[model samples]
Target chain A: MRIHVQNPAGTSAFSFTRAQWDAAVKRHPDMRDLEVTIDNSDDGWSAALPVADIVLTWVDIVGAKLRGCDLSHAAPRLKLLSCNSAGVDRLAPFDWLPRDIALLNNSGIHADKAGEFGLMALLMLHNNMPAHIRSQHAQRWAPMHATTLKGRTLVIVGLGAIGGGVARLAKMLGMTIVGVRNGSAPHEYCDEVVSVSDIHKTLVRAEDLVLACPLTKDTRNLLSRERIALLPRGARVINIGRGQLWDQDAVCDALDSGHLQYAFTDVAWSEPVEEGHRLWATPGLILTPHIAADDRDRYNDITLDILFENIRAHAAGRPLPNQIDPVRGY
Target chain B: MRIHVQNPAGTSAFSFTRAQWDAAVKRHPDMRDLEVTIDNSDDGWSAALPVADIVLTWVDIVGAKLRGCDLSHAAPRLKLLSCNSAGVDRLAPFDWLPRDIALLNNSGIHADKAGEFGLMALLMLHNNMPAHIRSQHAQRWAPMHATTLKGRTLVIVGLGAIGGGVARLAKMLGMTIVGVRNGSAPHEYCDEVVSVSDIHKTLVRAEDLVLACPLTKDTRNLLSRERIALLPRGARVINIGRGQLWDQDAVCDALDSGHLQYAFTDVAWSEPVEEGHRLWATPGLILTPHIAADDRDRYNDITLDILFENIRAHAAGRPLPNQIDPVRGY
Candidate 1:
């Protein structure tokens, strides 16, 4: 299979290093037969995309690359467009993707980085960092009280790879874990399990909350104003999922009204979140520019693992891991 | 034996609740033969400080309860003064403590809480929380890159209970651990163990540095300006040990000069670091109000365990655990 590497998002600075390229090519002997072509921002895609049997892409490049070039002329052998990200939302803007092409995300692999970021958000809020920052800037030597995770309740929405990673770390910190998701199978890290419909009950008891669920038509604005109100006052909220999964107004109001201690989001509806967006200055909101998962140090290695797995599976005509259901839009 | 409880810290606020007190007193049927007396801040110490055979105290209460009352008349039966804190530094003011009295510190018990706080401080700095705070107040949508613990080198200056906890968590986060201590015995959490004399060599390669070592005359000002200079530029320092262990001027200068990224300290030379102290206003210093080990929810429970063990051992003419060496001054 011929694979074309595309960096349409213009992150040439972070393109796969020579070692990463070597690792992927040498990962398995079978990969030796696969022809790979690399592309950069300076190079025009005059011929690469149209002839690629499989397009290896970045999360942010899908829409830009697709919009800038015509992919209808893609080689008939092009069966997949593999992404190097946990979430596939960045690919949504490219509506012209061929129906025959399977969309595979690097789901479980980047979970480590994403999950670590989620854990960071929890620690930041629990430590009352906002207050500390203010004190530091004002040169105030204040020893603010920090509430530890020991014996406190943590509620995780979504039982995916990311959520599982967060659960494991939270458990180590001595938190009691309550999980909410569609599946009912027992999750070892969770002390208690609840269905998606019962998230309200979970939120009421949650001192620290995490949202790692995929966004779909069924889950848009899952954390609505009323549902957010269901959470105990002073609860902390962290979003490692799509930004649209939370109602911005509800989150801002909660922080402003002091119903929520703080809200940290790694994803936003707008990539850079326009210059003066309300979330930027919201009292208890911390707007990080959507780089949590992408900032991972082992990002390329993890993405390569996913790519290798799917490649081997495809060769055997077996089911591909992390193949997204386009209609459901994960 | 008679046990007198003195809470001049008046953590009547933090004291055992009705149920907690009941549970402790009723913990063992053998306690029925023992006598226990409780004293609050309001209670006059006219007799409380004199007649107690075994005194159970909080670290903060030592100075407060000892200074105003005369201890020269302590009962002939007075045998032990057990503290519910890991450090007996607060007892420094009581130079006249009877040489015959065995002083016991709750050393390893709160290691869990203090270590967790140490881990918290690490996560905060590595996540670039300070920059995020700046962006939040400026209402800017800037996503700063943050370094992760994955594959980074961490040097632990002590390998005690608290250091061990921090090491375990750091390992889970993918850091390589280097330990320096007086003991040459291999520590499980450290990948490389070095003697006290090798600290400067360890500091040169450390990306993250931690001090969980005890402070004595030999260890004071351990992080002197020259030693701090040996650390790789931009190294982060965390002090969960006595405040005097670090040279305040050295740390402040390092942060201001951009040689160190940040320093987080739970202990200051003075509790409630005096207002306007240089440390209070140091650019990258976080002055936590000395509650790392003190806020532990298990404080009283751990204290009780020590008391019970000592009581049983003392009655049998056996040596008590956690007995402090007056010469070593732990």
Candidate 2:
């Protein structure tokens, strides 16, 4: 059984010490006879692999690197494709791969960090931090009444790992957690769960809405102008998921008109946003370079743990954890 | 027994209907009659008998009114003085008044509202809400990292009613709550309590500090420049109490220098702070026009409850609740 490791650009995984690699190798004794190959080239997957059983891939940047691979040509011996990312959208469209090839994802890796960011967004809006900062700079004490989360409603757009983490924390803070997902199912942390179809109606009642869904064909531009307009005045929003899921122009217009009191986003349609973006000039807006899930060490450690556990399960011929369904696009 | 109601500036209590006053008088059978009088006139105290059993005074604007009256002349009749406000600063320097006069105040009236404001300030600083609002108006999706409260430390400067309320809520959110008061007594909601002498050391370890202490002669400018400098960089501060406890120039300098991340203040040293105040130009500072305890209906109800309860206790020859020690100036 041979293990093939494909490294992504800018990943620090390449700097792993030989001693660490040996320790990891020793943990998997069943694969002691395995020949490991570290490939970091465009033609890394071009050669036919008749004996390769497991493929470990760490791709952070979305685009051609992971998706451009021709998986159909060498699907026979590929037992598993473990991705070091929570989102598998980049690999969703590939239906030509072997049916038996198990797909595992690092779902738990980013949950805590992303959830922390979500909580930050909720609290910042509730307290009106940005206005305070501006006031400090102006040496002006422009007093404003701010809202509190104790009796406010928080609507979570998705209830997966990241959203679930957020819901748990918000519930702990005495907030009413309302979750909106594709199906109507009871979630542990959510006080109420509504179907995605009723999202517009849900928005009207939510004091704060968190966008935590994946960017899929069904959810693309989910929070459009019509939907955003349904929210109550002074409602705050936080987007820690895909940016394309929201109608940027509508959000901007609502914010400018003071219809939506505040918005905190950690994801953008484009990375490293250009200068003079509308967000830069908008009042009551907080912008940061996309670094919400930037605890690289913790994320990598959790990802590796998940990968190791899955590998052990595979060796024992048991079902792997965090198995992703290509059709679901989670 | 008879009751004498004195209000220097004509209390809003006078707005109560005659029927309502009659109903209250009927409820307390120990009182034979009720006399409402404006205490602003020089001869106001002369009209009331020296043997009047109970006196209720409403003083909206603190200072002078309570001190100007010759309470010693009316001490024989004035068994109890029920004040309408929470702070007894205006009634301080009470040595000149009758030593036996029992003074009761409405201390817990603003608990919930002020607590909510403190929570709002914490959320705003943690989530950077104002920046997000600004971003939304610009139609920009700027991603930023936010701090969460799950594992942060909160240091409360005062552990009185308002501080206690804030500590309770913060503890529920999984934060470590530290309190600073005049003594080192253990607090119910706080994990640790330190004396005022240890405040500088305590500030160094706090991630978020709330100033809820009353402004007394000893507490004036309690958070001096040297003390503010002891705080860790990025520490957030919220002042729901009198702002005189914090040196405005020190806070402004700290915020401008990025030594302190944020400050939320509901009360300032001066009301309607002058246009060129340093607080107006400081960055990451939130100013609210001292309205944290402004839930009109709730405030009125609490005040009435305190007054009614104190009156009942006084009529029954019981010790009054919330008795203020003028020397301490609580």
Candidate 3:
């Protein structure tokens, strides 16, 4: 199978090199018989796309590279599209996605890092660290109280890879973990799992809320103003999914009204979160420029593992891992 | 036995009410026959201390009540001194403390809250949240990469109430937990435990160092300039135990030289952490006036539990739950 990697957004990005591929096949003997050709590049990658059966691209380069490159005319043989991000919300704007193509995301690999990010966000909010930081900047000595994590209820939305990791951490800290997802959770990290329909019920009991689901039509703005109101006043939220999933204005209003204690996000509407935005001034809204779960070497290692596993699964004609439920958006 | 209640701190601190004492006696039954006298006041508590067999006081008001009060002459029969604080450093100034006096601190009461504070400190340092907050204030969108918490090593310098809780939380977050104290740890929350003699060896392996032991001769300046230098460059430090354990100036220098990634302290030598202090301007230093555990309800709950247990143990002539080592401090 011919694989063309679209290193689109300038500089280098996550890719499966020929050497890495050979090592993978060597490890996974089932794929030893299949021949593989890789054309990884940034500049003339579209030229090699026509002969490719699979394309390793990124979620961030849709507008810059994917939009300009005509997929049907250039990559007629392409049967699969593997995204670089663990979450595929970056593919939302790509309306021309081929229906016949298989889509896979580099998930689970980033779960450990993403879970740590979620935990950090929760800790910062619960401990009143943001207010402490503000006081530190002014050199003012005003200390605020922080609630304990033990025995507190954490409602995790979307009990997937990242959510599972977060649940395990919270559980270990003596927190009562409840998960919210499309259906039942197959894992055992959380104390209980509730359906999306019962999310409002779960929100009332949640001292901390984590949004870890993927972005899709159904999940976009899933946490609406009404749902946020369901979370009793002063509840903390950490969103590691996508910015569009939150109604930013509603969140800002909740924070302003003190209805929400803190809303920390690693995902935002815009990547850089430019100046003159209301979000910058939103009280209790801790803005992070989306650099959670980083460590390039580790990131590359996890991504390579996922890539290798997906390739072996595809070659063996087995159901692919982390294959997004186009219907659920994760 | 005559029990005179010493309520010398002006208002109610963490004291058992007459009704509470009655209930405690009823609950224990063994202490029901003791003659309990009411001397709950600041003005004349010293006069009643002479006849007291046991004195219940607080850590915050030790000096105001204990300094001019002649304990040896007034309370020759004193068998136990119960303090309403997790650590007994507040009791260090009294050189006249009778050698026979069994001192007890309301330890393990504030562990959950203090542990949460420690977690917050680590998260803020690891995620670089202070810089993000600074950028938010400046309306800048500068994003920086963060190191993950998993697989990192954490050295908890005290495996007591607060330190053990912190170790448990850190371990749950996927960190390798090593503990350091005057001697061996009694419980098993950490991956390993070492003595103070082996602290330097442990410091070299610690990515994060937490000072959770009390202030004492051996522990004061425990993370001295020499020991601070022993830590790996860019190591993070969190002080929830006492501020004097760290050489603040040395920590500031470490932060200035980029030798320490972050230093967050809930406790300082001085409580309000006065203005014009170098710590206010120190790079990567996150300071908060010591309010790690400020839930009055929880405080009272934990204190009452300790009071009941200690009273029962004292009446039954059993060893106290949190009898501090006069030499090792806590």
Candidate 4:
């Protein structure tokens, strides 16, 4: 068996030394019988197609290009494609893949980091910290009365790994957690769980709404203008997931009108948003370049461990963990 | 049991509606409860002072005008003198006529309001919310990374009512609470408690330090230039107490040098701080006009209740609930 690994530049995993790689291989004795090819090139499509039994690819790679490549002429043995990401929207319309090939994702790996970002955003809005910082800089003692989250309601739009982590953290801070997911079943961390179809009705009860869902056909632009308006005045919104899940223009309008107290987004529709974007000027808006899941050391180690475990399971003819359901498009 | 309440406005308690005046009388059932004299005129002071069993006078009357007023002449009848404030610095130097006059304060009344303010200030510094709000107003997607308090250390100065409240709330949010007070007594909410003598040494461990001590001779300029330098870099300071507790120049310099991330202050050496003060333009400083304890409806009610409770205790010869020892000044 042989494995191929590909990742973006500056990722520390690319610098894993020979001794460390040897130790990792020793820990996974099954990999001793396998051949591994570490490919760090833009032309990974042509380079990795040959001799690779398993492929580990970065999230940014264009899935269509990988599928169109003539893999049978190169790496005919490829049986699995593992994504170093939680979402698989970019890999959509994936029906063209060989039927025997399996897809797995790095889903739970980013939970802690993303949940940390979401909690920070909520605290920022509730305390009106930004206004205080500006006043501090100006040496002005302009104190304002800030709201407390002690008895507030938090509505999590998804109950996946990241959202579950957020719910647990928020609950510890004395907040009431209300979760909305596609499934009808209630989550353990949420005080109330409603189907995604009742999201608008649930909005009225949420004091702070957090979006932590993947971008699927059913979830794209899920927070439409009408739904955004349904949120009570002074409600806050935090998005640590895909930016396309919300109607950005409507969010900006709500923030501008002071109807929504604040909104924070780590993921944007466009990377490196243009200078004149309306979101830049919206009142009570916090924007961060998509870095919600950024624990470099830990994330790299976790990604590698997940990949190694999946490979071992595959060789034993056992079920692969984190296997993506093609129908669900998770 | 005739009590005399002296306010600068010189309006008698009788000037209020019958219901309001009766409420005050009901709290002190032991009092003969004669009509409350206005005492606005200097002449009324001489007559009212002699016969009064209890005195609730304004701080202004106890200041420089002490030379002209003959307080000792009326001291024989006075059993209690309750100050309607947390600070008694002005009353400290005065030599009361007798040791029996109990000095009480409205301490616990302001804890919730002030603690809420400190929490808000800490959140502001950690989240960098104001910068985001400004960028949002400018319509620019200025992306920046923010710190979180989830795993940070919070150092609280003065583990009394206000500081204790802050510790309780921060502890609930998963923060490690370290406290400094006059004594080294163990505190229930604090993970570690240190004496004021060890504050400089403890500063190194604090990521967020809150000033909640009263302004006193010993604590004046406690956070001096030399001591401010001892704090961990990027540590934030939230002062909900007296401004004199911190060295303004040193704090400004730390913020300007980017060593101190932010400062939030509700109290200043001067009220309605004049324009052109250095603090007004200091980066990372939040200036609030000392309204931390200003929950309009709750404020008056809480303070009045404290006074009423003390008056009742005084009339029955019971120990006052919030008595302040003049020597310690808290």
The number of the candidate with the highest DockQ is 3
**TM-score of each prediction:** 0.92, 0.76, 0.89, 0.77
lDDT of 3 at B77: 89
Candidate 4 stretches with Cα past 4 Å from truth are: A1-5, A10-57, A62-67, A70-80, A96-101, A129-143, A291-298, A301-321, B1-103, B106-153, B172-175, B233-238, B261-275, B284-321
Q: What's the CA error at residue B122 for candidate 2, in Å?
A: 4.2
Find the 10 residues in a row with the least total lDDT in model 4 chain A.
A11-20
Ranking by lDDT: 3, 1, 4, 2
What lDDT tens digits, residue by residue, belong to model 1 across residues A235-293?
98998888888898789999999999888887787677776788777766777777666
Tell me how candidate 2 scores on lDDT: 0.71
lDDT (10s digit) by residue, model 4, range B29-112: 643355565455566666777877766655566554443455566556766666666667656654552466676677776666
User: DockQ (C-alpha) of model 1?
Assistant: 0.48
- For model 3, how does the per-residue alpha-carbon lDDT over B1-330 read when each residue is reduced to its tens digit? 666656544455445567766666666676666777655565557566777777667665555666557777767888777787777776775565677878788888877887777877787788787677778888899877766787889999988778888887777777888889877655587888889998889998789999988788778899999999999998999988888998988998999898888888887878787888887767688788887755544665566567668777776898888887777677
Give residue B73's lDDT in candidate 4 (0 to 100): 68
State the C-alpha lDDT per candidate. Answer: 0.76, 0.71, 0.76, 0.73
What shift in Å separates residue B180 of candidate 4 from its native position after superposition? Answer: 2.3
- The deviation in Å at residue B271 for candidate 2 is 3.8
Between prediction 2 and prediction 3, the one with superior TM-score is 3
Question: What are the per-residue Cα lDDT tens digits for candidate 4 across A1-330?
Answer: 677776554554334444545677777776677666664565754676676788877756536446576656555887888888888888786675666778888888777666666766786676665555445545555656554465789999988888987897777667899999997698887899999998888999789999999888899999988999999998899998899999988898998898888888877788777788766645577676676655544565666677888877887899888777777788
Residue A14, candidate 3: Cα error in Å is 5.8
Badly placed stretches (over 4 Å) of model 3 are A8-44, A62-73, A93-95, A184-187, A325-328, B1-40, B43-51, B184-187, B293-296
